[model samples]
Target: MKNQYQVHCDHIDVALPYARNSGDGALIGSMFGVCANGGANGADDVLVVKGVFTLTKNSAEAWTVGEKVYWDNVAKNVTTTATSNTLIGVAILDAANPSSTGVVRLNGSFS
Candidate 1:
């Protein structure tokens, strides 16, 4: 492997082995690059990534947004509703700590 480093992120995705129930309805993460502990041991507290954009403030519940969202699997934190989902304006903010490793697929708002 090359060099891997995680930074502050706003909208990202993570894969954990368990699921979490944080009522904040928002977290933070970094863009996809690569990590050492990047594993596929799906967790339960996961944000349940999918094509659904309807993420709500409810824990483990999916809600809809306008622009973007961030899901931290390891830390089980999340943040939704952004301005732009482009790679240029990628938003990533560091969580209380960090999150697990997973795919960070970007999506767009409906027209």
Candidate 2:
């Protein structure tokens, strides 16, 4: 097909919305993905849009497996709170309060 460029879209190259480190989760205008490399804001970088990853989360909040999670862009971490945040994925494992990380599977698309 003339319109076909590439098939798989599990990853994408985008101008970063903010400075990021490798493995950082980013939400660029409703699209969410994990940074494949670290770069300054506005730099073009590959974002992995699918997979399970251990990401930094709110240490004060606990998470249960299968619970929907959101990206706290201001805090630069994951949270269970839905208010004013972007939904990124679901927790794959339970996380305890004061824990610094949580396992998540990226949804690859917004609800």
State the C-alpha lDDT per candidate: 0.30, 0.92
Residue 81 in candidate 2, Cα distance off native in Å: 0.2
| Per-residue lDDT of model 1, residues 1-111, tens digit only | 255343324223555433223322222243322222333345223232222322222144233323234443344433442333212112232222123221223332111
Candidate 1 lDDT score at position 88: 12
> Which is the leading candidate under lDDT?
2
Q: Which residues of candidate 2, in runs, are more than 4 Å off?
A: none
Ten-residue stretch with the least lDDT total in model 2:
4-13
RMSD versus native structure for model 2: 1.1
In the range 12-105, model 2's lDDT, one tens digit per residue, is 8889999999999888888999999969999999899889999999999999999999999899999999999999999999999999999999
Model 1 TM-score, all chains together: 0.22
TM-score of each: 0.22, 0.94
lDDT of 1: 0.30
User: How accurate locally is residue 23 in candidate 1, as Cα lDDT from 0 to 100?
Assistant: 23
